[model samples]
Target: MTKSDPNRILRRLPLAVGGLGAVLLLINRLLTPELTESQARGDVVGVILSAVLILTGLIWQQVQPRSPDIVELIGEEGFVLAQDLPEAVKTELAWASHLLLTNTVTRSLIVYYQGKILLRRGILAAKAEVTPGPILKRVLETQKPIYLVALYVYPGRIEFDYLPENTQGVVCQPIGNQGVLILGANAPRSYTKQDEKWIAGIADKLAVTLQE
Candidate 1:
């Protein structure tokens, strides 16, 4: 018996796709012999097929999604979680606002001090009063973004009664040990590595800002 290497599959994908594309080209050429110039144009079928095949080949190699560098920056820092302030939390909230303004986040809610939820963009459909302090507490405790799949978890915490019918996703980030930045979208796509980096950068900076 012979042992097979798994990596060989990835290396052979391009060749396999190319071969399949060649067979397709041959079949196409045979079926439409008079359209040689059209086929040669390389703009209609061949080029598209080639590009698709190449991408397919790459996908088979266990291509992982790119994670941004910011994740490491904020994932393990244990600071600013044991204090309360009036002005510091406000600054952090402002910074979180900046983060939401620059991204495609469709909905957001910031909870300050005790549990005061500040509506940034869309409304929250949660049950609680949607305060900023509690949310920030969660972020400080978990250091992870909370992905709200729907509006049933904390209906009072959300103010979704005002948004249009195009709501999608939501994300909340705690920054400056005082402010909570909330983001929402109308589509189902969650945060990406780049998004996380931007959030972490803002959060870390906000933390410093709150300290000062």
Candidate 2:
């Protein structure tokens, strides 16, 4: 799932809750006319208050800045990792690569093991040996993902050495000790925190699968 999915759900939640409350209130007013004026007013007020609180909560949730949670975004089925390195595994990797490309502004995806390219998709300059530069090495050492919102904004960024021409942003994640996964895009700030979390989850799954 992309970032927009949750936002869409959140946007509709208030409407749904409010609609339900309104329907219940209308039914109560029509069917229970025998109730005292005070009781009817109390019921209407309770329904209105409930709907207002729910709408307010929805608005607050949308206003709050939240980093996309990977599990919440994709759930367990989306995190399925192949158990062995086979044709199926390659297919699965390609599927994941394509999924990321479709969801984000990614133009190129590369997976490298040691000094050799294992899988590559989209536009990229070919090289015999993919060298791990200083920044990449640091990511591998720390086993953390790195996001460069704008390649040009960082002078002498190591990613520029290996990334394709005109690549503007990148999100690189270390796939255990097996290799590294790099995603390249042409626009600055194309990848969000949610993308990082999603890719990290993928990297973790890939690491576990490769180790097994």
Candidate number of the best TM-score = 2
The sequence of per-residue lDDT tens digits that candidate 1 reaches over residues 1-212 is 12355577766688588667867777877787477665578636675787677777766565545422221111111112223446665656655665555574444343433244443333434332443344435765776666554433555334433223234555666655455555555445556667767766776675565556
Off by over 4 Å in 1: 1-99, 107-129, 132-137, 149-167
**What digit string (tens of lDDT, one per residue) describes model 2 on residues 20-61?**
777877787789848897987888796877689677757756
TM-score of each candidate structure, all chains considered together: 0.41, 0.57
CA lDDT scores, all candidates in order: 0.52, 0.69
Relative to the unseen true structure, what is the Cα RMSD of model 2?
9.4
Which candidate has the highest lDDT of all?
Answer: 2
Worst 10 residues of 1 by lDDT: 70-79
In model 1, what lDDT does residue 165 have? 29
